[model samples]
Target: MTAAPVRLTARALLLDMDGTLVNSDAVVERCFSRWAERNGLDPAEVLAVAHGRQGHATMALLLPDRPAELNLADNERILAEERADTEGVVPVPGAAAFLASLTGLPHALVTSADLPLARIRMTAAGLPMPSVLVTAESVGASKPDPEGFLKGAADLGFAPADCLAFEDSGAGIAAAKAAGVRVVGVGPRALPHHPDAHADTLTTVTVTAAPDGLLTVTVG
Candidate 1:
């Protein structure tokens, strides 16, 4: 027999960008691959830790001895490259419909992308930008630090425990969980993180808002 769908209730929703709503792996791979080769690091390994964290943070992890300032500068260049190269960026399956379902609901985009990068990717993906956003510049710390997710919950006027986060990376899931928000794992990348609910894609998830201001999210 098929298992019953998992249902989660929350006052607001927090969303991660890259792997969750937008599929920008093509650009990410191309940009990071070049950066990795330049630094004499393996592209695959860099990409492995690249998603869901600020570029600077990813650089720091791969090159621990590098000065923080250099990482920051590298992050700027990487963001520029990513922003200019939206060749393969597109919305994930059901992303448009999913966002439509959240109309008039309390939700925020909590992502490691800086504002410009986030805007371009969303545009390339043909997805609407959430009115409430907690991008990289909005927080001092990156994913796995809980800063962005915490700020997202606060921006939506909901306590962390009252929010549900949708993430597609281990770092993003960790950050949400650390901020006291239950997570809905999106895509294969999020599976190992073990979110409260798992969906292969947004196609398997649906959301509805109650008159009392609660959101019911169902993941099949």
Candidate 2:
């Protein structure tokens, strides 16, 4: 059964990067594919475990037989290319309007992306730079561990239970729940995960825009 829609009364919103705020599938696939080919690894295998995971973690999983040094090096290389390559990236529909409506809302970005890739992907997606972002480098543990979401909540100066998380991946959903935050899953695949709320897209949700450009978004 699906959880109830998340209400927005907290001081913050922790949004995931890929699939949630933006769709960077092509770019992500290309980066991983290219890196895998260069390293004599299978592109499909690499990509199979890439989504919703940090670069370092992906490297460990994909190139497990490789030396730690090699994995570290390749992770860095992949990160660099991803940061420089943002083609075809764009914000998920209604993301901009949703962000615009919450003019004074205290929200933060929390993603598995590292600093550079986060900035690059977000910019390519045409999303404004959030005042605060919790990326891979900031957390000792990644998604599914709840560290990223919990850190994001802490950064926003709010209790985890008081915050709402927007996520697209199963791992991200697990992380949010582990952090004690309600979650809204975006897109179709996310629905089966039984998020607190589900939407076809950010566009499907309603947000009231005031004359001053402020927005009040209602969930569920």
- Per-residue lDDT tens digits of candidate 2, residues 159-190? 89878888888778988999999888988657
| Regions of candidate 2 where Cα sits further than 4 Å from its true position | 1-11, 38-42, 63-66, 207-220
Question: Which candidate should be chosen as best, given lDDT against the real structure?
Answer: 1
Q: lDDT of all the models against the reference?
A: 0.94, 0.80
TM-score of each: 0.98, 0.84
Q: At residue 138, what lDDT does model 2 achieve?
A: 96
RMSD of each: 0.8, 4.0
Residue-wise lDDT of candidate 1 within 1-220, one digit each (tens)?
9779999999999999999999999999999999999999999999999999999999999999999999999999999898889998999999999999998999999999999999999999999999999998899999999999889988888899999999999899999999999999999999998899999999989998888988899999
Task: Report the poorest 10 consecutive residues by lDDT, candidate 1.
Answer: 206-215
